[model samples]
Target: MLANKRILLIIGGGIAAYKTPDLIRRLRERGASVTPVLTSAGAEFVTPLTVAAVAGTPVHTQLFDLTTEAEMGHIQLSRSADLVIVAPATADLMAKMANGLANDLASTLLMATDTPVMIAPAMNVRMWDHPATQRNLATLKADGIRVIGPNEGDMACGEYGPGRMSEPLEIVAAAEAALSDGPLKGKRVIVTSGPTQEPIDPVRYISNRSSGAQGTAIGKALVALGAEVVFVTGPADVPPPEGVQVVRVETAVQMLDAVQAALPADAAVFAAAVADWRVAQAASSKMKKEKGEIPTLSFAENPDILATVSQMTKGRPPLVVGFAAETDNVIAHATAKRLRKGCDWIVANDVSPATGTFGGTQNTVHVISDDGVEDWPKMAKDAVAERLAQRIAGALVG
Candidate 1:
C-alpha cells in the first residue's frame, strides 16, 4: 500500500526509541523510503549508527549542521517528505509540538513541515495517564495529528499500562493509511454502525443480533481511503476505528439526531441494525411479573433514518447506502427497500440462523441499485466492507 512513499520519521526521546530500527525496516519492507531524524534524548536510547544501518541512509541530528544546511536547508528538509511520523513521542516532545515550541531540530522540522503528521506515543504509564499529557494529546488531535498507540504492556519502568509503542507492523499499517492516495481523499462521509437499542425500561431494551463487525470494518476501509469519516455508532461489539470523529448513540431516534447533526456529508452509509419498533411508553422503572400477573407492552415504529436522510431536499448526501438483513427473498426485498428508502444502494444479506451472518465474520451480500442487483460472493465481513467502500469511492469520484 505504501509503495514508493517518502516518510520523514522523527525519533522522540523514550525507552521505546530502541524499537526505531525495526520500525524502519518494516516501513522499508513495504516500499517506503525512510529519512531518519534523531533527537538528542532519542539518541541516548538508540544511536544514529543503528538507525542509519537499518534505514540505509544518513540520519539527521542537528538543526545547524553546515554540511547538509549548505546542500539542503531545514525548510527543504521539512518539505521533502510525503508524511512525517513521530515514533515514541515523548511527553516533552509532545508538549513542545502542541505548544509550538521549536527549540530543537525535531520540533523545528515538525513546525515547518506542512506535511500530514502521525504520532506513536510512548512514555511512563503514569506520565501517559497524566492530565497534562492528555491535554497535549487533545491539542495535537485538534491540530489533525493522527495517533497510533501507546499500547498497554509491562514497561521498562516495570509499569503496566498504555505506555508502550505500537508494534512495527502496526506502525507500518498506520503509515500506509496516512499515505494512501485513495479516490475518497478529502471527502466527508458518515457511517452508522452497530445495533441501536430502544429502551423498554431502565434496564430493558429492544435490539438486534448485529455485532457491528461490518460497520466497523467499513469505517476502517473508508479511513484507509483517506476520507474524513464521522462514525455515528450504537452499542457495538467492536471498538471504533482510530482517526475518525466518533459519535455514540443508543436509540434509533438518537442515531437519527446524531446523523442529522453530521450533515453535508458526501455520502452516508447506514449499516446499523436499527430496531424496527420501540416501546410506546416505557416504564420509569424495571417491571417484574408478580404472582403470574403478566405485563403488557405496546410497540411504536421507529423513525426511518435511511428514508429521512435519503429523501432530504436540502443537505442530503449525494450518495446514500443502506443495509437489509432479510430471511427470505433477499434480492427482491432489498430492491424494494432501496426504492422505498430512497437510498442509492442497498446491501442485502441473508441473516437466517443457517447463514450465521448476524454475529458471524463472513457475509454473503447482494448489491441492489437502480443499475440492478449484483450478487457478491460470500467473504469475510472486512472484505465486504472494503469492496463497498471502494465502490462508494468510485461513485463519489464519478
Candidate 2:
C-alpha cells in the first residue's frame, strides 16, 4: 500500500529513537523511501551514520549546511515527502511543533511541511500527563496533525503509564492509513467509545462494563477506509486505535463537550456506554464505610450526549449513529431508541450476561434505521466494524 511513497522521518531525542532504524527498514520493505532527519539530541541516542545506513539515505541534521542548502533548501526538502513522521516525538519536540517554533532542522521541516504529518509520542509518564503537554497535544490535533501512540506499558523510567512509543509495525499501519485513498478519503468522523466514569468522590466513581473493544475496532476500520477519525473515548480496557485524534474524557459531560468541540464531521458514532446517573453531591473526600450505617446517595441524570447531538439545531453531522446495548427485545428497543434519540441509525446489540457482548470479542448486532431493522449474524467485533464502516462509507461517499 505504501509503494513508492516518500516518508520524511524525524527521529526525536528519546530512548525510543532506537526503534527508528527498524521503522525505516520496515517502511523500505513496503517500497516506502525514508529520509531521516536526526536531531542533535537524537544523535546523542543513535548515531547519524547508523540512521543513514538503515535508511540508505544521508541523515539530514544541520539546519544550515552549506553543502546541502545549495543542493536543496529546507522548504523544498519538507515539501518533497508524501508524509512526514516523527517517531519518538518527545515532549520538547511536540511543544515546539505546537507552538510553531522552528529552531532546528526537524522543527523547521515540520513547520514548513505541506505534507500530512504523523507523530508517535514518547515521554515519561509524568511528562505525558502534564497539563502543558496535554494542551500542546490538543493544539497539534486541532491543527490536523495525526498521532499514532504512546502505548501504555512499563516505561524505561520504571514508571508505568501511557508513555511508550508504539511499535514499528503499528507505526507502519498508521502510515498506510494516512496514505490510503479509500472511499472516505475526504470524510471526517467522530467515534465515541468506552464507559464514562462519574466521580462520586476522590476515589469512587460510577462506571459500566464497556471494554471499548467494539468502539476501538470501529475507529480502526474507519481509519482504514481513509476517514479522518476524531475518536472521543472514555476510560476503556482497550487502547484507542492509531491514526486518529483521541480525546480522553472521564464523564458523560466531558465526552459531550469533547464531541461538540469536534463537530462538523461527516458522521458521528456514539458507541460509549455512558453512566445514566451521577451522584448529585459527591463528597470532596472519600466516603468512609461505617459499621451498621448506610450512606444515602442522591442521583442526578447525566447529560444525554446522543440525543443532544442528534437533535442539534445547527452544525449537526450528516449522519448520526447511536449504539443501543439492550438486555432484552434488542431490535424493538433499538428501533425505539433510533426514533427517540433522533439519530439516523442505531447499532443495537444484546449485552446480557449470556451473550458476553459487553467485553467479549464476538457480537450479534441489529442495525436499526428508519427503513427497518437489519439483523446481522454473529461475528467478531472487528468484522462488524469493517462492515459498518463500509456501509458508512457508502452512505457518505458512494
Candidate 3:
C-alpha cells in the first residue's frame, strides 16, 4: 500500500529516535522513499550516517546549506512529499508546532508543508502527562495531524506510563494506512454546496440561508477516503474545505455550468440550496425610492440541476444523490422528491426556522432511497458527512 510513496521523516530528539532507523528500513522495504531530517537532539541519539545508510538517502540536518539549497529550497523540500512523519515527536517539538514556532529546520518544514503530517510521540511519563503537553496534543489533532501512539510501558528514563513510542513495525502500519488510497481512491465525485444567488439587480440578489457547512464537511470526508472531489460551491458563510478542487459560482445557472464541466464522476451529491426562480426582467440599475410608484418584477424558473443530471442519457454518474431541505413533512417531501427527480437517493432534512438547520452546526436527516428511509440521529455536521461518505463508499464498491 505504501508503494512509491514519498515520506519526509522528521526525527525529534528523544531516546526513541534510535527506533527510527528501523522505521525507515521497513518503509523502504514496502517501496516507500524515505527522506530523513534529523534534529540536533536527534543526532545525539542516532548519527546522520546511520540514518542515511538505512534510508538509502541523504539526511537533511541543516536549515541553510548552500549545496542542498541550490538543489532544493527549504519550501520545496517541505512540500515535495506525500506525507510528513515525526517519529519520536518530542515534547519540545510538539510545543513548537502547537505554537507555530519555526526557528529550526524541522519546525520550519512542519510549518511550511501543506502535506499531511503524522506523529509518533515519545516522552517521559510526567512530561507526556503534563497539562501543557495534553493541550498541545489536542491542538495538533484538531489541526488534522495524525497521532500514532505513545503506548503504555517501560520508559527509557526508568519510569512506567504512556510515554513509549510505538514499535517500528506498528509505525510502519500507520504510515501505510496514511498513504494508502482508500476504497474510494481514484474515484471522482462531484459535490455541490452552499446557496446560489439569483440576481434581482446588479447590486442585489435573492439567495437562501445555506452556510455550506454540510457540503464542506462532505467534501472533506470524501477527500479523507481518497476520492478526487470536484467541489462546486456558491457564496456561503462557511469556507470550503482544503484538499479538493473548488469551482466557485454566484448563481444557479453558473453552478450548473460548472457542474456540467466537472462531469464523468463516479457519484454526484447535490447539496446546494439553489434558488428556484430568478428575476425575469431585473432593472439594469438599482431602483430608487419614488412616491406613489411601485415597481413590478416578473420571475423565471431556474434550471433544475439535480433533475437534469440525474436524468442524463449519457455520462450519468453511477450514483446520484440529491438534497431536500424542507420546512415540513421532510420525509414525505424528500421521498417524493427522490422519485420525481429520478435520483438514486435523497438526503432529507428539516430546515424550518425552529430547527436551525440552515446555518447550524448539527443536523438531523433521513436518507431516502428506493429501498426505504433510514433515520439518522442528530449529530455534528462532520459526523453526518462521514457516515454518508461511508455509505457511498459501500454502494460504489458493491
Candidate 4:
C-alpha cells in the first residue's frame, strides 16, 4: 500500500529483531525505500550484513561514524524520511524515548526528526505491564506518537499476555495510511463497544452478541487520520486498538461513567450492543440448585446512554452516531430511533439468524440520517470504520 514513501527504520534489541529483514523486503516490494539504523542491542541478534543485504543500502550504526559524516551527515539522515519507525522497541528504548535520552544515534535521530514516529514494542510481558513502562507509553501517546501492536500471544519467553511485535504486514498498512492524507484528520470522536456484563452473582450476568471488531476498527481509523479518539469499551471479545485511549468497563453503569469522562468530543458513536435489562438485586453468592424450584429473576431497565448523550445541552458532541440491531423493519425503526434519541445519524444492520453480521468481520450496513438512508455495499469492518471516520470529520469541519 505504501508507494513512493521514505521510512527510517530503526531496529531495536530483542528476539523480534530477526523479523526486520523480512519487514525491509516487504516495504521495498511495496515501492517504499527503507534506510536501516541498527541499535547496539539489535546487533547481537542479527548481523549488520543481513540488514544491509535486505535493505539494499549500507546500514547506519554509530553516532560518530566518520565515513557516514563524509557522505550523509547525521543532520541530513534524521530528516530525510516521511516517517520514523522503531520495530522491536525494547523497554530500554521506550524508556529512553520517554525521558528524551539522546545518548545514542537512534535516540538522537528520534528526538531531532520532526517527522511522525511509529513504534512497535516487543518486550517480555512483565516488562510491558511494568508501572514505569506503562507510564512511558501514556507519555508517548499524549505527545502524539503513533504506536502499532505489541499484541497478545505466545512469546519467546514462554509466557503470553500482551507484548509481541506486530506482524510486518500490519505495520506496513499503518505506514501507508500515515503517508496518505486521511479524510478524517482533526476530529474528536468517541466510540462505545461490546456487550456489558451485568452481575447476577459474582460469576454470572447478561450480555450480547457483540464481538467488538467494528467498534474498535472505527477507533483505529480515526486515530490513523490524526483524530483524537476516546474508546469506551465494555466486556469486548477483542482488544482495543494500539494507539487510542481506552476506558474499560463491565456493567452498563460503568460504561456511563466512562462516557461522561470522555465527553466534549466532536462525535459520539454508540456502537456497543448494551444490554437493555439487568438484574435489579444480584446475589453475592451463587444460588444453590437444591433449594430452588426455579429462580424468579427481577429485572430493571438500563439507562439509554445514546439518548442521554444525544440530548445533552452542554458538552455534547456535535454529531451523535448510534446503531440499531433489529430483526424486522430495520431502517424504519432505526430512523425512528434517531429521531426519538435526538441523534444525528444511525447505522442499521440486520443481526437476525439469517444474517451473520453480528461478530462477523464483514458487514452490510445502512447509514440512516436526516438526509436519508444510504445502503452501503458489503465491506470489511476496517473500511467501514474509515468511511465513518471520514464522514465524522467532514461533518465536524463543514
Candidate 5:
C-alpha cells in the first residue's frame, strides 16, 4: 500500500531507539522508501552506521552540515517527503515542537514542512504524565499534529505505565493510515472498548482480559479520518487519544448507558469485551470466606449494549459493528452474532488458549459482513483497527 511513498523518518532520543532498524526494514518491506534523520541525542542512543545499514542511505544529522546544506539544505529536506514521521518522540522533542523551536535538524524540518506530521512518543511514565508534557500535547493536537502512540505496558525501566512507544510494525501501519484520504470527514463515530468491571464488593470486581488496544486504535483511526469520535472506554492502561470525546465506565450497565448517550453517530463499534453477567446481588461490603468451601454466588445477565444500540430508535448509527470472541466454531459464532445483534458487521477473533486473543498485543480477525467474510492475517491490533476504520470510512463516504 505504501509503494513509492517517500517517508521521512526522524529518530528521537529514547531507550526505545533500538527499534529504529527494524522500523526501517518493515517500512521498506511494504515498499516505502525511507529517509532517516537523526537528532543529536538520537545519535547518542544508536549509531548512524546501524541506521544506514537498514535504511540503505546516510542519515541526516546536522541542521547546518556545510557540505550537505550547500546541496539540499534543511529547507529542501523539510519538503522532500510525502509525510514526516518521528519515532520515539521524546518528551524533549515534543516540547520543542510544541513550542516551535527549530534549533535542531529534526525540529527544524518539522517546523518548515507543509506535509502532515505524525509522532510516536516514548518516554518515562512520569515524564509522559507531567503537566508540562500534557500542556505541550494539547498544543500539538490543537495545531493539527498527528500522534500514534506511547502505549501503556511494562517499560524497560521496570515500570508498568503509559510511556512505551508502539511497536515498529504498528508505526508503519499508522503511517499508512496517515497517507489515507480522509473519507470519514465530518462523520461521527462511536467505539466502546476494554473489559467492563462489575463490582462484586468494596474491593473485588468481575472483569475479563481485555486490554482495550484494538478498540482504542479504531477510535484513533476514526479521529485521523476527521471523524468526531465518542470513545466509551472501561478502565484502560493507555491514555485515550487526544481529539476524541471520551466516556469512562466500569461495568456493563455503565457501558450501555454510555453507548446510548453516544448515539446518532454515523458509525458505532462495540469492540469492548463486556461481561455477560454480573453478580445477582452485589454486596456493599467485602464478602468474607467462612469455611474452606467456596460460597455459592448467583449470576444475572447484564444489558446487551450492542443489541440495544443496534436497535435504538433515536438517531441510530448508520453502521453498527460488533465483536465476537469464540473458543470454537469461530466463523459460525461470528455469523450468528451478526444476525442476533442486528449489527451491520461483526469482527471475530479466537480467544482460546492457543490464540491468546484476550490480552495479547496481536490479533487475527475475520471481518464478517453480509457480503462475505474477509480473513485478516495475524497483525498488531493497531493495523487491524486502521484497516477497519478505512473500510468504515469508505462505506460512510460512498
Candidate 6:
C-alpha cells in the first residue's frame, strides 16, 4: 500500500533508537523510500552510518550544514515527503513539537512539514505517566498529529508500563492506514469501548466484564477503511488499537466528555459497556471490615451517553450506533433500546454466561434498526467489526 511513498523518518534520542534501522528496512521492504534524520542524541544510540546503510539514503543531522543547505533547505526537505514519522519520539522532542520550538533540525522539520505526521513515543514509565508529558500528548493530538504506540512492556530502564515504542511492523501498518484512500476516506468516526470504572474508594471500583476486544476490533476496522477514528476507551483487558486517535477515560462521565470532544464526526459507535450506576458517596479510604457489619452504600445513575448523543439537537452525528448486551430476550430488549436511545442502529449480542461473548473471541449479534432485526451468525469479533465497518462506510459514503 505504501509503494513509492516517501517517508521522512526522524530518529529521536532514546534507547529505542536502535530499532529505527529495522523500521527503515521494513518501510523499504514495502516499497517505501525512507530519508533518515538523526538527532544528536539519537546518534549516541545508533550510528548515522548504520541508519544511512539501512535506509539507503544519506542521513540528515544538521540544521545548519552550509554544504547540505545549499543543496536542499530544511523547509524544502520537510515538505518533500508524503509523510513524516518520528520514531521513539522522546519526551523532550514531544514537548518541543507541542510547544512549537524549532531550535534543532528534527523539531524544525516537524514544525515546517505540511505532510501528515505520526509519532511513536518511547520513554520511561514515569515520563509517560507524568502530567506534563500527558498534557503535551493531548496537545499534539488536538493538533491532528497521529500517534502510533508507546506499547506497554518492560523498558530499558527495567521498568514496566506504557512507554515502549511500537514494533516496526506495527508502525508500518499504522503508516499504511494513515496513507490509505479507502471508501471511508475523509470521514471521521467516534468509537467508545471497554467498561467504565466507578471508583468506590481510592482502590476499589465498580465495573463490568467488558474486555474491550470488540471495541478495539471496531476501531481497527474503521481505520482500515480509511476513516479518521477517535477511539474513546475505558479500562479494558485489551489495549486500544493502533493507527487511531485514542482517548482513555476511567468513568462514564469522562467517557462522555471524551466522546463529545471528538464529535462533529460522520458516525458515533457506542460499544462500551459503561457502568450504569456508581456509589453516590464513596469512602475516601479503603472500607475496612468492622466486626461483621456490612457497609451500606447509596447508588446514583450514570449518565446515558447513547441517549445524550443520539438526542443531540445540534451537531449530532449522522449515524449513531449503540450496543446492547442482553442476557435474555436479546432482540426484544435491543429493539426497545434502539427506540429509547434514539440511535440509528443497535448492535445487540447475548452476553449470558452460556454465550461466552463478553471476553470471548466469537460473537453472535443482531443488528437492530427501524426496518427490522438482522440476525447475524456467530463469528469472530474481528469479522463482526469488519462487517459493521462496511455497513457504516456504506451509510456514510453512499
How many residue pairs of model 3 clash at the backbone?
Answer: 0
Report every candidate's CA lDDT.
Answer: 0.89, 0.92, 0.88, 0.84, 0.85, 0.92
The C-alpha stretches of model 3 lying farther than 4 A from their native spots are: 1-4, 7-180
Query: How well is each residue in 258-337 modelled by candidate 2, as lDDT tens digits?
Result: 89877778899999999999999989999999999999999999999999999999989999999999999888888888
Per-candidate TM-score against the hidden true structure? 0.66, 0.84, 0.59, 0.74, 0.63, 0.83
Give the Å error, residue 257, model 2. Answer: 4.3
Q: Flag the better candidate by TM-score, 4 or 5.
A: 4
* Native-to-model Cα distance after best TM-score fit, residue 266 in candidate 5, in Å: 9.2
Q: Which ten residues in a row have the lowest lDDT in candidate 5?
A: 237-246
lDDT of residue 370 for candidate 1 = 86
Residue pairs clashing in model 1 are none
Reference-based lDDT, residue 164, model 4: 88
Kindly list the per-residue Cα lDDT of model 6 for residues 25-50, writing each as its tens digit: 99999999999999999999999999
**Alpha-carbon shift of residue 338 in model 3 (angstroms):** 0.7
Model 4: CA > 4 A from native:
70-72, 185-205, 211-268, 276-320, 326-344, 349-390
Model 5: how far residue 183 lies from native, Å: 2.7
Per-residue C-alpha lDDT of model 3 across residues 30-80, encoded as one tens digit per residue: 899999999999999999999999998999999888887787567888999
Ranking by TM-score: 2, 6, 4, 1, 5, 3
In model 3, what is the error at residue 126, expressed in angstroms? 59
| Cα-based lDDT at residue 146, candidate 5 | 68
Residue 382 C-alpha lDDT in model 5: 85
